[model samples]
Target: MEFSGCWRNILSVAIAVVLLSLAPPLAHTARAQSQAPASSTSNENDIRAATVLFYAAFNSALHGDLAPMSAVWSHRPDVTSLSAAGGHAKGWNEVYAGFQNIARLYPGGNIEQRDMTIVAGKDMGYSVCIETGQLRSSEGPMVKFNQRATNIFRLEGGTWKLIHHHADSNLNEADVSASR
Candidate 1:
């Protein structure tokens, strides 16, 4: 990753860590704060839709399909991601490669975000949430996956494109290991 991309990834992960430390009632807070003027609401709704697509693609990626992932991510040079499965990627190509690796390491599984808090600006937005589910590990054991993630998106050509994703393994779940 470039220096700027590294910094953005760090900041995004730090924000997610802080959010994870907070109590679990922020869903309502997020909804209330997202209420705004018509234009802002439209943008927020668009962002939410992008998030939905992201997760759908995310689950698909886990099962060895990367085509859906292409639709939600920006084909940019600055995108970066640090996966909970233990790898770092910089730029769109590298990021997609990382997902390909994930598809290889995790051939089957499901992951879904919870208590996501969305913050949308005019051109950029981010989401902080917990990813919980079961993933069949590379060793063929289904493991509980409790992760804290932060996803950053950019408004590109009137659509929200995911520009960065940082996922950290949270071992709060009993006997949970790295999903890799």
Candidate 2:
């Protein structure tokens, strides 16, 4: 009877020791599972807000205002922009210069983004959208444009900033009008 009691106590202690040893990893896994949905929702919200900011900045650029556009961009050396007006621009200075030229030429416009899909990761995201806009040229003629555009963003200092913009000007007036 004495030997049996001692063995039972030993078994209980061994089990407790094993459980305690496994507790950290188990707790971490449970915490991660509980937080996963919240984290995903927060990331989605951030991505949407960033996309809205991007459109606002694009509109500001369309209106020939560089301040907002400047604010939205990452301004890093790796930043890049490619558009009909700017051809292909790389680096902050080159991209800014391209925007300057685009602003000068396009002046103001009403742009509608359709079929936009945004995917966000830990610190980066990419969006693809169909941009249809009518731009009033500096000379006062309205030029309609339809382009497939993709934009890449990076999270910097807790805000999403545009890192790359690539747009194609393949669609003509007829194509844009037809889509409308």
Candidate 3:
């Protein structure tokens, strides 16, 4: 009887731990559901604008200007990015630094979205697109950059702000940076 009671207690504790593990995501989902837009179309449209602003800021960064980038992104701890320069940056500071590195690596480029697709969920949205452009490398040579990219955004204070941006292409970090 003693051994059986101990096993039951262990089972109870295991169940409690599982429940606690699920709490954060469940709470987040509830908040998202409460704040979800009635119109998915409206959400998509808003996220479209956010994507446009993000790409605009991205292009500006290629031109060695980061001011616009700051305006489009959420300055939150969850912000993240995976850039062409070959690094995974997490948090706003790290992500911003990645953008700075892009500005340094390619002082000039214009990447335009092609074959784009956008999806919007409760308080969250994402866009997948093909990015095509010619970027001038740090060595002053122009190279074609074609990348599959994904941008994620979340509603913050009634504004859609970028939380993540990922881009991948053939050019490596060494090729992108002359100083490498």
Candidate that scores best on lDDT: 3
Give a tens-digit lDDT track for model 3, residues 1-180.
Answer: 455888999989999999999999999999877766557879998988888888898898888789999999999998889876688999999999888888887888788877678999869999987777888887878887767789999999999999989888854465345222
Question: Relative to the unseen true structure, what is the C-alpha lDDT of residue 40 in candidate 1, on a scale of 0 to 100?
Answer: 71
Candidate 3 residues lying further than 4 Å off, grouped into runs, are: 1-38, 170-180
Local error of candidate 3 at 30, Å?
21
Error of 1 at 91 (Å): 0.7
Model 2 ranges with Cα > 4 A deviation: 1-37, 171-180
Model 1 spans > 4 angstroms off: 1-36, 171-180
For candidate 1, lDDT tens digit of each residue in 35-104? 6556676777777778878999989998888999999999999999998867779999999989888888
Per-residue lDDT, model 3, residue 178, is 29
Q: Where is model 2 poorest over a 10-residue stretch in terms of lDDT? A: 171-180
* Residue lDDT tens for model 2, 29-98: 9998898778667766777677677778878888867898889889899999988564789999999999
Candidate 2 structure lDDT = 0.82
Error of 1 at 156 (Å): 0.7
Query: Pairing residues by index, what is the TM-score of model 1?
Result: 0.73
Q: What is the C-alpha lDDT of each candidate?
A: 0.83, 0.82, 0.85
lDDT-based ranking, best first? Answer: 3, 1, 2
Positional deviation of 73 in candidate 2, in angstroms?
0.7
The ten-residue window of minimal lDDT in model 1 covers: 171-180
